[model samples]
Target chain A: MSKQAPVIAIDAMGGDHGPEVTVPAALDCLRQYPQLQLILVGQDAVLRESLAAHGRSDHPRLRIHHASEVVAMDDLPSRALRNKRDSSMRVALNLVRDGEADACVSAGNTGALMATARFVLKTIPGIDRPAIIVTLPAANGCTHILDMGANVDCSAEHLYQFAVMGYELVRAVENVDSPRVGLLNIGEEEIKGNEQVKQAARLLSSSYLNFIGYVEGDDIFTGQVDIVVTDGFVGNVALKTIEGLARLLGQALREGFQKNLYARLVGLMALPVLRGFKQRFDPRRYNGATLLGLQGIVIKSHGNADRAAFANAIRMALLEIDKAVPERIGERVATIFANGAGIHEDAPHTTRMNRA
Target chain B: MSKQAPVIAIDAMGGDHGPEVTVPAALDCLRQYPQLQLILVGQDAVLRESLAAHGRSDHPRLRIHHASEVVAMDDLPSRALRNKRDSSMRVALNLVRDGEADACVSAGNTGALMATARFVLKTIPGIDRPAIIVTLPAANGCTHILDMGANVDCSAEHLYQFAVMGYELVRAVENVDSPRVGLLNIGEEEIKGNEQVKQAARLLSSSYLNFIGYVEGDDIFTGQVDIVVTDGFVGNVALKTIEGLARLLGQALREGFQKNLYARLVGLMALPVLRGFKQRFDPRRYNGATLLGLQGIVIKSHGNADRAAFANAIRMALLEIDKAVPERIGERVATIFANGAGIHEDAPHTTRMNRA
Candidate 1:
């Protein structure tokens, strides 16, 4: 690990809330880690105004990147990337490519971000595709799920690559040396699920990754596997369903406790413990999803991320930078695959972070 | 509405907690609806023991129909139906066939139950297949989703018929007249989704079912549509996902509200209101899913249903009998393709419920 501070480039114009949430969160990140540096990528005017409103105009750690174009949420991915080169999303990816920052993070249109990242930075050597890796908070600890919403349609080979990439990312950043990977299926039996899942199971079982066999949808949060792999469509649905349920359930609990006077008193006595529990399951803490298999570090935040969520994304980027995750992932992937196996004898020099 | 009460045969030996849950629920149903008559079908000794425990050694409203054979949960539907002739599930459906009972309900192995129902108490004259319809509590109220796990493989025409059946069920029972029918797709656009969804959309748009075009996964809970239709596979995944989310979110909310003293005070104040809210979302209240399009009524309860859930299934069966839902569905389906439509209209009438 290097003493040099890692710089996080944030897409200030991304997310439903835009600079209002992103700016305050970046400031919070700076306050929490005084050693951290930030390059807010968006319209300079907007970023400056937000910083001034938050009473942090002349902070030594924060800077701005003037990206004039903004990608609308509903725009087509490829069209948006090709037509809007100076877009905040593209500019942020470019920052990582040019070594202007250690990592780039966005809470924008997922499709556009993935397309731009892949187009600009390209996939890592020996990596076929980049997967969106989300860290889910379970009872035991955090488990990583890949392809949250990157590739809606995937092949067995693609899923196999995703598992390997996911396993490496979890290992490198979280230090889970042998993260077990489970292929998501309708049932645990080999004979279950659609054609794609069946094919994925076969490939996963044959791959060198620590495959833990098939798992049902309910086993996701049980901490039975360190990495759960699936296609983006199913993965996205599963993630959003959890989010919706959390909101619906939270509201239900509040209503239940206040139904009567006796319950009200009990609720008051249990408030502190309940609050702690809420914080533990708070989606804000686990807001960032790494764009694994990319040549450089790219993290995606929730579209409606608030200040706390945005800060967590920055913190995640810093963690990845500190752990030299990209370099480790590249080495592991290159060695695991036949294409780059011959060159692995010479351990390539790790890409050093340069904070400006 | 007939002056004479409709007798519903019950498969008392079905479900994981069979006689215990089924017996109490039947008694609860009798108490709620004095006009309802129940014929409990199971082992004579076990049924007698259960009835005695419920303080009804010789209740006039309830009768026992003993059967010697049983169907295990994992038995193949076709094989089970062919072999288990004297099974409780089989006898219940047989009672319906012999005009001894108007309908039958079971919480047994879903596949075996569906198979037996299709084999003995067959499909209506115009109904090509039967679908499992479950009510989901949404923001606005409740949405009826069909084919939750009935038919794994279906054509666009099957989906179209499901919409009609679901719409009719909602109107007859839930009293939502002119119910909106939505085809569940990956996206809201008409062009989006797989071949089946697109083809179904075309058929639905032309049909008299008040089709609302394609809806995304999130729209299922918006209560924007009365019925959302899809194939069994996707529906099962969505249903299970919703259930899992409910459990996870419920736990998270309890923890969140009791986090600290001030929050606990708020939580206490909010307890009563929260309980009322939670009751509205209680899974038990929304447990029963009707196997629609069959000549005889067949209601399937949740696998882990308690007494309350089983009771709800009985209540659902009573409603079906009171409304003559099967006949209504049959009539509606008969007129659906009466203009010499190209699709097949060869539904059989088996009236058999092979209990597993």
Candidate 2:
């Protein structure tokens, strides 16, 4: 597609599966995107063993960038930041910051990744913090929900900024010019929810967004809106609830089939149909969590993601690189602040909330 | 079974389906529990006409108590408590206050039920606010979660009370002698949640209750704990999120089966097995939302419940009555407070929260 390929630097030793998953996933991604290159950032000896085990060697399009240290999954973000300066996760992010790679993908600890990325690449101007944006499978299409445990305590204006950033994400990735953005709350009525969310709703209503007012928890999967915004605490709980319920439902379905002879036969007979149904709700197809409001592209894959899911994460970075989503977001933020969206950088008072 | 049956008053004209759904559901409950008596409360003519239409009329076991007005689903809680003196919802609660009924079950607006019940039946001596408790379907059994929207804002001590009440609920209804009580938070760690939750955890760990530290949102339906305690804001959104996801999954499955001729055949072949799966997850089986902390029993059914679901709500009321759950909860509260568990009644500063 191009004479020079776009490069993605991957934290090869970051996830639970580590190189066993990332090596093959990266190889598969390289195969899919002919005009793409990869830099596997990890311990040199370990990466070489993984590559040899997969019966592959470094090529013109693939290379290994050695980082001696590994960031443990439970390592505190501050520890990773201060001590593990040369860790794989940080090195990959640095590649992006230095323009050596178009984007960076990591399956490392989410908290640490957010902290390291924000520290290395810095946040976009006019943005206070970076947020984790996840794509969930809804009825009509994928629905994006943000602030998924990135900032546990968010101000009203912070939530308003999330709405704007979310709006830009959907428009860029999903080709949705008029993405319906809704603030997640306890009820659809404007009068519901706590004070922060209520104020956020007011700010969104006045912005140049296709703001759909307040939506309830059920709206997350109803495909009623393209993007949903909430504070880190509630958003994180809601997401984990969905994950836990999905696993339970799958287990229950299997248990139901084991109850009787007829049930077992039906399970066998409808295996094809059930497979289709399962794939429709497959969580792996949507594996990447983009760190929005960052100056450079960074994606976080689930820790237990397999080869296919990890590859999906790489593809996600490629899409962002192809479209330059971060630049567009920065432009949108500048416009929003310029138009008196809020005096976020220096104003101590709650000006937008007060105006609302 | 005793010759003198436990009487349950039903708001005959409540819920979205009204008497059309309620009359049949009451009859079903009567058939199931021979020792149960029901008082259908509504406008005399509407009750009588609906009862006759369903081939049911006044009987020795079934009777009518006329309430001239109905509480509209969207009626403000304050308005319902102040103006709607003759509402069916209020009349039903009055029966419990007057000891004319063992319990009352209504499918009316939740806010109205909580407000009216608090005004008429009053809260138990130690509880400042009554909470709405709902039984959610879990992997092992029904898991109870509370403050399911009745109290929009709650402090740490209020959460402690929720734990005690939840503990007694499991002991009474499910026969779990030492019910495992857990506070719901974003993480299972003691330091995972906001200030209110962390303080609640401290209070609960020090209390006499068999508290099991903190639980995440997924624990609600994992059957890992008997009861999950959270503030109304998080609890309500989590419960409704589960509801929405359940409905979406069901719709997606049906849509999957309707895709092609081969899928259609599989649907037929697996009809019985799929039917079992559907029943195992039947939302109607988990319809009751009891208003915990009240002096009398008040259960809130989903406003759109059908005959089977509404009947399930009636059975829930009967079970609470059979176990004398309110009486047991009151004893537990007295036991908890008697042991010098901070003077929450009046502390001048942050009274409800300062107890911890």
Candidate 3:
């Protein structure tokens, strides 16, 4: 390619639909972002056939890289790590690690993707573990929720690191000078949550981020905070809970309007408005989950993501690349640890350090 | 007094609205359940005034049981245990413990209520800790979720106890012969969740309950299982997340239809349909969390619950009493532990107990 555009690697042989979605999504993203180059890492014949069907056989900026193996969704992390050396997912990450691409997007097995990314790119210094920060559509616009399914057994220090990393992520991507970050807990009271959560709150209060004291689960969609910090288990549960409820609500709404003739007529009249709401709150729009704390940007798309959803994942990776998120997080975390605040466990709430 | 009815004790001076909501809710529940009796436990003058305002002061079926002190929401559980000897919350549970009331319902401080209940009622044998089990609206019907905000640092055995207790509660209340019980986790795979969850799954599988291997957070609203079990931290976060997302979706729907003149016209036409939808998903309808594993039945209403919501909590308590839920659980748990499963911590998944 002659243009000086950002290159993003794609795991074309990932997800349920594989190339059927990824190849189209990559092409769609290239059309949207003029200064974008794509590297499709998968079996050559499968990608070529799909690209041929899409009538994009020879784009100037698109190149196909062949990979032999694929990681199945149910494959254990250990098995994936040991078995799939030259898999599409591994190859995509390898490209990013080699500085051949600015970012990598994958819709493969979450466990495998996280394991490979952590192993390949390694974590930024002062960051103990990597986190999967997924943004969901909230009352305002969206809220960045971290540790979706990455670190299950997080320490107080690990939680504090998540809060700092999440804070920096929101600031870099959304460009908020001081993003309001809330530690997800059962209640809003200062002394209400579990030990780890309570300790993290104390650590966050001592940091530079605009830390809003313990926000309950409902605060996630209340538009009160830009970022919510939680351990992997709780965050993963909360994110999936949101997705489940959204689908349930949509189905309920549809059935509620189809019961009677009058209701059906009302549904007809309300179609435009409902369509608008659907478009606004579509899960596909928020499909991409950024694998934060890596040396380079890596976007993890939903395993069942469609073309539009996979394209959105590419857009998310592009945004991270443009803002230099990893560097920003590294600098912020260095300051946090340098102050010796994050080094201690269960720091007393009374002696919280204020950002001056 | 003439009727042979179940007597429910209400903590009239608890919760955010105090007697304003509790008194009215008690009256409303009494009105709905013809043979139901209620005891208002609170300060004498306050109870009398609230009862008189509702014009039910002299009703024979309703009586005042005076308690001098009130438990504040922010009061530490330890302080509440040490200081509030005659608080309304404690008095209500005392009625149940003394056999004067079939069940006790409180909209008081959750921690204080849990502490007071455990101290006063103690736990049923074989049950390590009490869980906050609440039901939420789902697709086919409703789903029961436990450990809403109690026992954050749960052992695998504690989680197993919760599952057995929760499973029995569903069978008694819903009358499903063998309720499908799922261990709430981040993924559906056996090796997916954190340590405690995996161990709990093993314990559950060996037991007689229809243990569904692993269910994710989204599965809660899908109505695939009658009971979903998790530690207090994850369950509480999931419950609150549902509430928050429901509120956001409601607001989004309202705003979506009120966009333009035509949209407003369509919204007006769809008011009946929308009202039906709202009624079906009303949070108040799903109010009242049952504190399971206690020797006596203790129902916890949301502290911020209104009249309808608090009344629903009373209804929930009545249902449990009618079903003899605690006694049934007591018997079932005796059998479960008799198999020597409850005592072991981190038991291997394969050595799970068989029905034989």
Candidate 4:
């Protein structure tokens, strides 16, 4: 698979901007990666018009796949799954499921996209559910957090699975021989957190993985761990809270600079430095969230992503395609299960070692 | 209660800095509010030594209440509750329990403080648990979030009770006639969230309170609602994530300004504006988290709070005392129960109106 050029399916009619953003992003990805091929799945006429708007009727690496339906941003996942089989999101996933595309990218309704993808490409063997994993900027380098908004009510066994998946992904992509994985909890104490987290902590502790016990929320940015595993509800809330705070701080900084003439002059002088800081922590730079533990690769871009952010999502899919993350996770899970260290529902929780 | 001067019990031996921070903070509070009386609960000699170090032997408004024990920051709640009866934290709460103080402020182990406060003051009638409520700087004015780190697990009925408590607190303290209440969930859609949040949403919708349905994490800072309610685990994680992101951004901005000679020169000119911006969102201004639903007012300061932040916590306790937060919440709960709008354990989930 690595020998062939990477082929990605784009949900052209998804997200707030639909084909206007995804089409240009698809073209940008093709331009950046000469060996890349993209399948734009949407209404044929709309995609063609978007492509024409970009000064191209057609490209050798790009093909338009007709998808009659488009999932609305407010569509319920179950409704989208049952009704929108011909949706751009579903068609993109179908392309990947049929092995025509190495991966798929979509800036669509997250719930609808997840439902369609899961229905089309089922979870890998020994995996109960697929989790969304995203890389976030940290003090040292970066941190990968899983179950961003996937499974809401994850069991202890499911959290253990997320840990295994996150560990393998970090090891494979970041080239970390032993990625430090931490279970996200309210406190870094052995006795903190609810029953599920405590049980998950026990599972991670007994495993061969480089588990760094319970970590509090602040640890996510402290660069104390490589991967943070959490239930989707907590992870989603944390991620969105970060976004909200970033927005708030950004607004406050802008208002401060525009307060008065002297401050505005000083802000003018500080523009370059502030821009550099902004670029360093730009949400656009970290746009893609991968659906891990699936049989195939699917990257969920932020629904409001512009061309550049959508292109970044495509870049993520290409990287995952090159790394074969799913295959590696499968092998790791298989090895752990064969060693009788995999998730066992009936297994009693045990504390083997203190958290590092 | 309003006619009498407010007397606050202080846990002087709590938090990271102990007497070094609490003593000076208590003194500053005494100086700030002429009618305020403070009781410093700690080792007699240590309190006196701290007071002497601050160029004071005693003040007319300040009194020392010596305790034989100190609760360590790492002490388990159960252990602290079972054995540390003479601990500063317990002694402070005992003062409130015995009506020696109108309220109590502690920068101590949160678990221990909550556990001891619950055991001492007990929950208000019809309130099953006490929740920690903190006011946070938001896009417009400020937003209050409850269950900050109190109950790890919450039922739908418990969440309904939280909504009533939060609504009452915001109304009494912020002076909003109808505070917009929102239940924090993964998404704003009615279909989103786990069973607990969805069930809670139904309860909120049926209530007479200005209950906005489900709210996403980012809504906390959008100033879209006055109160956001969630289980303690999610609330704690969200709050910590905000702190982590803030610290990360502050460091990044500092590093950006110090990158070069030109940047540093611009940074010097930008200092006043930056300082103003920092003051606008300073965490110290929002230091105290009220333990709502308790029979007496209890304020929990950040364990690492310095003098300014601890003083802010005292101010928060004073504000609650002035507004009679606990009394109002108790009355509100009683009214709701009298109207049969209170939590019904076996109430079937009902959706009456679409979320506004």
Q: All candidates' TM-scores?
A: 0.88, 0.94, 0.92, 0.94
Candidate 1 C-alpha error for residue B221, in Å: 3.2
Chain B TM-scores per candidate, in order, are 0.92, 0.93, 0.92, 0.94
Compute the DockQ of candidate 1: 0.28
Off by over 4 Å in 1: A2-4, A125-128, A187-191, A254-270, A326-329, A335-356, B76-79, B125-129, B152-155, B186-192, B249-274, B339-347, B350-356
In model 3, state the lDDT of residue A178: 90
Per-residue C-alpha lDDT of model 4 across residues B1-356, encoded as one tens digit per residue: 37778889999999999999999999898888999999999999999999999998989889999899999999889999999999999999888877788889999999999999988877777787889889899987999998887888999988989999999989988888999999998872433798988889898899888998888889999999999999999999999998998999999999999999999999999999999988988899899999998878899999999999999999999988888888788777877776554433331111110000
Question: How many clashing residue pairs appear in each of the predictions shown?
Answer: 48, 0, 1, 0
The reply for model 2, stretches above 4 Å from the true place, is A1-4, A188-191, A339-356, B1-4, B188-191, B339-356
Model 4 CA lDDT for position A80: 90
Per-residue lDDT tens digits of candidate 2, residues A1-356? 22346789999999998999999999998888888999999999999999998888776789999999999988888889899999999999888877788789999988889889988877776777788899998887879999888887788899988888888888988887899999988752323788888888888899899999888889988889889998888888888889889888899889877888988887887788788878878888999999998878899999999999999999999898777778788788887787655434532221111111
Error of 4 at A182 (Å): 0.8
Q: Model 3 over residues B255-337: C-alpha lDDT tens digits?
A: 98888999999999999999988988898999889999887889999989999999999989888877878878878887769
Error of 1 at A253 (Å): 3.8
Against the true structure, candidate 3 has what lDDT?
0.85
lDDT tens string, model 1, B1-356? 55667688999988888898999889988888878889999999999998898889878888999998777767677767889999998889889877788788888888788888887777776667888899988776888897877766678988988888898889999876799898876531222466776799999998888898876676766667789898776676667767755665566667566656766677666656666877899999998899998778889887668999999988888888778787787678768767655334554544322110
Tell me the whole-model lDDT of each prediction, alpha carbons only.
Answer: 0.79, 0.83, 0.85, 0.87
CAPRI-style class, candidate 3? medium
lDDT of residue A66 for candidate 2: 98
RMSD score of candidate 4 (Å): 6.8
1 against 2, candidate with superior TM-score? 2
- Individual DockQ of the candidates? 0.28, 0.53, 0.55, 0.57
